[model samples]
Target: MAQTDLVPAARAPVLAAERLAVDGQYLTFSLQGEIFGLEILRVREIIGYTQPTEIPLMPAFVHGVINLRGSVVPVIDLAQRLGRGATELKARTCIVIVEVDAADSAQPMGILVDAVDSVLDIGADAIEPAPAFGSGMRAQFIRGMARREQGFIVLLEVGHVFALDELAALARGVETAEAQA
Candidate 1:
């Protein structure tokens, strides 16, 4: 599918933030050799690798639900959701549990990642506007790029990544693909 079909516009508002106002602590992690960061405020907890129950009629990226302390939380394969293939399961692979703004409520979700990096306090000056094109990701996927000594860590807007509306669209895409197959 084309990139636009993947980056649903319904999710854009989730991570939309101004460069100057985007400064905050972020939790960084790796996905397909790329470093990405999520606003620390959105992260609820980090847990060890575990398989989640697969759901029918859902996108492959929707790895399915896991019982978290009694509550069922949906886990998303962050790599696949971003257009990269599903993450290769490994010792370092783990889930980053996050809470995203869903309409008026805060919905909890899990983000599967290759490995957990570290939490960093990124200043406003360190943030640069997302490039218009050729970032290997949609402009909305990135909140901003944080300048680092090694390079730039793409700051991901977690809410947009897990927006209910966008995810529903992605699920529909999966169904379409399966039907064609």
Candidate 2:
């Protein structure tokens, strides 16, 4: 029997490879009291909370830069970026380093979260379209909502959440102003 013999010809339509990639393991974490998830593959590492060197003119959510093995990496406060408010750093607070896509390359950035949660394997069937409201954050930042036993975990589209171009522009502005000072 051929592979097509398993399914009805009418129901054997294929989907794009990219579309199928959405369902996979996610690294879940908490922001405020709500749970959120990021694709595990993007995560580089998690480190203990360290005060970042504040960069003048950067946005409030941009917690400034940290030296990771001699490389300066900008840390973003996810709570404030999501409009929830600043994250009150506690014992469990840590930075989740993720590789976000830039214009022509991937840049490593840090996202500060309340605490790291467990990894979850969410299937496409368990995912739902982002709702129009009540997500707390902007709808565009959400990839989808993954239904879990506890509740729905807002799966973030990291590229949208951390737009490198916008950040780069702000950095350029700061650099220009500093040079003339």
Candidate 3:
């Protein structure tokens, strides 16, 4: 008589992995004692504070351009642009290079920041919507606010900040004057 094969033992149950709400990451930094962040994908590189070659007739916020490996990129003072007083450059000061596309062009621009903190992995649930209150800076430039142990980091809409349409118009006017000369 052929012996019947023993029935296989039941396998242990496997639990499904819990999905986290937070997905994307942000680069957190400080400006005027307030925290701020930008999506890591938008940030190209970070460099220490350096003297920029001032461009004449440009807006105060436009700190001029710098030669980064043969590429000329404009630098904007985020503090001044947000209506905050000029920030004194400290050892921690840095320039965060951001790539922004314009309506008519696709060139990237660089923005000078006070200091960089760390890269934070924030979930969607961790981000809080910006308040409706009229903050000094335009609401359009805000992506959302992220809360951290230190405080809330104002996440910036880099695309809106570096659009440069207004500045491009002003630059066109100067170009026209030069052409007429």
Candidate 4:
């Protein structure tokens, strides 16, 4: 089967208020020896790492864009985005296509990971609220911490990770200024 076909078609169920309140299933992946997860709902597809045509003046984390079915989607390196050491693109590296919802629009974005892990069915009971201190990552970027058989998985807030609002606003502002010029 094709990679697109392997992507989960149906989204997992949202937790009810009465339930433990975890978001949904997560597609766990590794980066710099740490395990991190992204909400499976936002995941569109996963493809092996391929060199992307570099674009200038963008953020350091922005690895450039790729052509998926003719739609250009920007890719961000999760390792660099998380402030971890830079990752050497290898055979195991893969790009995870995520759909981030911007404040003004709903558009999908892609994130590159060192390696894609397994899909974990973590429920509310298994999750603990993110710690305020001692987490190397910014608190805003984290959703929660999940306990797993191997160890702990840092659940990432995919929307916040890309800071879609800030990026979209910046893009809009540039357009507006260009129009005014």
Residue 2, candidate 3: alpha-carbon lDDT: 21
Compare candidates 1 and 3 on TM-score and give the better one: 1
lDDT for position 111 in model 4: 83
Q: Please give the ranking of all candidate structures by TM-score, highest first, separated by commas.
A: 1, 2, 4, 3
Error of 3 at 105 (Å): 6.0
Candidates sorted on lDDT, descending: 2, 1, 4, 3
> Whole-model Cα lDDT per candidate?
0.86, 0.86, 0.76, 0.78
lDDT, candidate 3, at 124: 72
Better of 1 and 4 by lDDT: 1
lDDT of 3 by residue, 4-99 (tens): 332333221111011223358888888888888888988889988888899876667888899999989898988987778887788899999888
Quote each prediction's TM-score: 0.84, 0.82, 0.78, 0.79
User: What value does the lDDT take at residue 44 in candidate 4?
Assistant: 86
Instruction: Write one digit per residue (lDDT tens) for candidate 1, span 30-97.
Output: 98898999989899999998889998879878999999999899999998888889999999999999
Structure candidate 2, residue pairs in collision: none
Mind sharing the TM-score for model 2?
Answer: 0.82
